[model samples]
Target: MKVPGTINSRNPNSQSVFENSFVKTLSIAVLMGIFLVDMGLGLFEIFSTKESPLPTAVVLLIFAVIFIAGMVFYEKQGLDTLSSLVGGALAGFGFSFVFVSLVGGVQFALGGGISTIGWDQVISAVAASMIASVVILKALSYKLQNHLY
Candidate 1:
């Protein structure tokens, strides 16, 4: 027997869970797409098709690590929305600058260096990082508010 206004659904929680998962997946893919396109355009001068695949892979790996680490740090720090976004931007800029600088330095020391990575790379990386963070946060926020309200 069931109350008229209190019917039970065997999978009552299923809808919210599925929706959350879908939103997370979609947001992540969008972030990744933007990051890849920006990286490709930014690095074209530094890496030609012949020598690209490896550096591109390495750079993206670093970005992924930074992205995850930044998210964890922001969550742990309990940063507000804007603070988290700014922190991400700063972290991304510093990480990109340092990573590329060291790489450029090594190549220079080896006497085969043809170019360097600089401000544009850092700016793009930072912007992409912040954008990704905000996107995830915004998606989660809406989902949470929907459930709560």
Candidate 2:
């Protein structure tokens, strides 16, 4: 019989540093910061241009590199892959919503008290961030797993 509050020696894969609440919260916060900054920059580049595709491509490349690097680092730390990915997506969504709301508030405050912010853009940003993070995480995880084995 396994005793409570004792490590299960039979389960080698049961060890997870991310199981700690503090560590998991910190990880989510880190992911949120990363998504905020990365997606913020990408959104800026995207909205700054209406006739250019090069900037968008550059943003995608930058995000890809960052996501791959993060995945490798997290994998090395033995974080659960599914949890990490889900956290990433949630972080992305949160960041997108916050960023857009802030921008809208700023615009309302500065532009003669007029609200010109588009809700569609905010929604699109949230969706894009969530979808992109999930896809990127999956691809990187697959590649990393293959390389390790």
Candidate 3:
């Protein structure tokens, strides 16, 4: 069994750098997709003048719950590490969405009516979540490779 490395080089599929990187890259892409879709819905609610922050909060909460269920299901496939990254990203997006839609709405609810949920915040949150997920999962995956396989 190989010891853990900074990056995941523990692809049980093949003992090659290319194979391990491919698996990690694919997993990262999946997590990114999940985050983008969830956050996009949150953004839609945030921008809708009639809906208010409540809808965005509800949507994010729903996503958080669903994400947990998804992880549980994926875990059985021996894909827990990949699943965890997706879960973390969903959480980050959910929190950022709620924070921007609710707390930032003070100005809008009061009158001057400024949108608190800017594209910048959404983009930054997505990037931050994706980056963190990759780092955390790569480290943990390398560590758990022996035990998992």
Candidate 4:
């Protein structure tokens, strides 16, 4: 009784459940939620704590999520590899810039009236994070290119 051009989820012979628009939108929303929550927690920890914001477990999780999502988007959108790399690298650099600045500011505020954090540390941390992000994302992107659905 299903229409020829309509999606029929109740029909056993219909397309995959994931092929539905709602499912796709929900999945994307969930992924975006994960990324947003992770960034929020990281920012909160950076400003409210004396510890480094770059927790290994948390950072690795974010990186994995970003890499997988980026690759999927790249494949779906037919994005140029070079543009993706550059865009991702710039994003990483911008994030690191903000993160390092907050960390440095916190350290300065908590140094008991002395500025313990120096520009060298901030520059080095930003550079290191930007380089690491680019390398990791590029490697993963290259390995997974055209291999994902």
* Clashes per candidate, residues 3 or more apart or on different chains: 0, 0, 0, 0
Provide the RMSD of all predictions against the true structure, rounded to 1 decimal: 16.7, 14.2, 13.8, 15.4
Model 3: residue 116 alpha-carbon error in angstroms: 4.5
CA RMSD (A), model 4: 15.4
- The TM-score between candidate 4 and the true structure equals 0.33
In candidate 4, which residue pairs clash? Answer: none
Per-residue alpha-carbon lDDT of candidate 4 for residues 13-127, written as tens digits (9 for 90 to 100): 7788699976765555554443433344345556666566456575555555555566556656777887666555555556554555454444444553222345455445555
The CA lDDT of each predicted structure is: 0.59, 0.54, 0.60, 0.55
Could you give me the TM-score of model 3 versus the true structure?
A: 0.33
Best by TM-score: 1
Query: Native-vs-model 1 lDDT?
Result: 0.59
Better of 2 and 4 by lDDT: 4
Candidate no. 2 TM-score: 0.31
Look at candidate 3 and tell me the lDDT of residue 117: 55
The TM-score values for the models, in the order shown, are 0.35, 0.31, 0.33, 0.33
lDDT of 4 at 121: 50
Q: Which structure is stronger by TM-score: 1 or 2?
A: 1
- What tens digits encode model 2's per-residue C-alpha lDDT throughout 1-149? 88756866456566578788767655554565445544464445446543333344554555455555666666676878976665555554554445454454444335533224455555565556655655666688789998865
Task: For model 2, give the 10-residue run with minimal summed lDDT.
Answer: 107-116
Which regions of candidate 1 deviate over 4 angstroms? 1-54, 112-149
Worst 10 residues of 4 by lDDT: 108-117
Clashing pairs in 3: none
Worst 10-residue lDDT window for candidate 1 reads 106-115
